[model samples]
Target: MVSKRGRIDTFVAKRLQIPKKMVRNLIASEQLFIDGHQVLTADTQIDEFSLIECQGNVLQQRQRAYWMLNKPKGVVSATIDNQHVTALDLLAGIDKDLLHIAGRLDLNSTGLLLITNDAKWSQRLMAPKSKVTKRYLVTLANPIDSTYVAAFAQGMWFEYEGITTQPAKLTVLSKHQAMVELKEGKYHQIKRMFGRFQNPVIELHRESVGEIRLDDELGEGEFRALSTAEIHSINVNASV
Candidate 1:
């Protein structure tokens, strides 16, 4: 027989309107007990047969979350700071305490951005072995040369301030615009790469990552959580 009555500690916490985290902290600090047995983890999943008490403080569950933010230009992708604006600021009314960005877009660049508290999934996308190809649409102030296209695709090691980078996959989508894919990410990379040819970027947008494209319906500064199908597809495509 199953009942929703719950365990001793669980019943006590729920009845007293106390949070489980506080209950855990109480247990950790030796301020709580269950039938004279000391509690260790909050995950004890207690029933009416147990006992629970909190000397002081409250507890709450951490909400797990994931979201895509249509990051507008001039937003920094960091948390825990007072600045003009951070990508986390875009999460207003969103699940607070969500983790870091899966990949980064430059502050001056605008487009799709993924934020999730899931460390494992975040690590998967950021892993070097995954080699997830990120697609970017770049509009240059000047027309692109065909010779540059060949060299860009063949891989051009960008050297700046004594630091050199590996080659990237580059292609020309049009005369004044180009489509480039990079398996590796660096600080302000795309902008610097085009700077070498005296082509200043007029506009930039990240179109896709692997097989998942940013939803076209999303306006600037808008976002939605990715479906499970999209998440699975990233892993599947990375394997191929």
Candidate 2:
């Protein structure tokens, strides 16, 4: 619901179809907001144009964003990995419950990854049914050949743990490099699949995921809050 004049927490909750008590709790916790500023009192009212950011997770509202990171090599993606420093370490002050990595990225592989407090955004971006496009740039030890390219584009077989992967895009970007766009992400997939071709991947970088791309200006380990425009783009692209 818009932050209309004369509206309160209870009214907004009812309009959004969320429980009033839950909305009140968010307000009490200083999680409710008016135009990006936190509001502690639920009774605070504003004009319809005021932006509302509920620290409360509203499934139907779909307004929060998880950042897409172009993960760098040597950084573990897990939140807790044998007590070793992981990607979560970079999110210094974020509330644990409001933040989580959207998907997996191997320690050696770097690329576009989603991190967010919004569970629906996470699920929608990572779910197989969503078919969100994921692109990667790979460096190989040996030059790629036409034979490998044909087999990959035609749907090469990938077997791991008890499952075989469906076909994926495998196009050569350069003599010793290739670009792969995949809809499904598997464990050590890019390295494993190309290993069959006798060309081991030396380095990997994820360029983009879905409609979001890693900001080139953001240095490694630096982060910025997601804007409302970026968040809105998620829904706009998902429908297509």
**What lDDT tens digits, residue by residue, belong to model 2 across residues 17-63?**
88878878877778776766787777787543356666554322323
Compute the lDDT for candidate 1.
Answer: 0.71
Number of backbone collisions per candidate: 7, 1
Clashing pairs in model 1, backbone N/Cα/C closer than 3 A? 6-47, 7-46, 7-47, 7-48, 8-47, 19-59, 22-59
lDDT (tens digit, per residue) of candidate 1 on 1-240: 121234445654676778766655666788755555566766566542234445543233344456778888888777655765888887777765546788988777878788877665667777777888788989999989777766666655655545555567777888898888888677777888888788899888898877778899988888888888877776675543
What TM-score, over all chains together, does every model reach? 0.70, 0.68
Candidate 2 global lDDT: 0.71
Which runs in model 2 stand beyond 4 Å of their true positions?
1-65, 161-164
Using TM-score as the measure, the top candidate is 1
Cα shift from native, residue 13, model 2 (Å) = 19
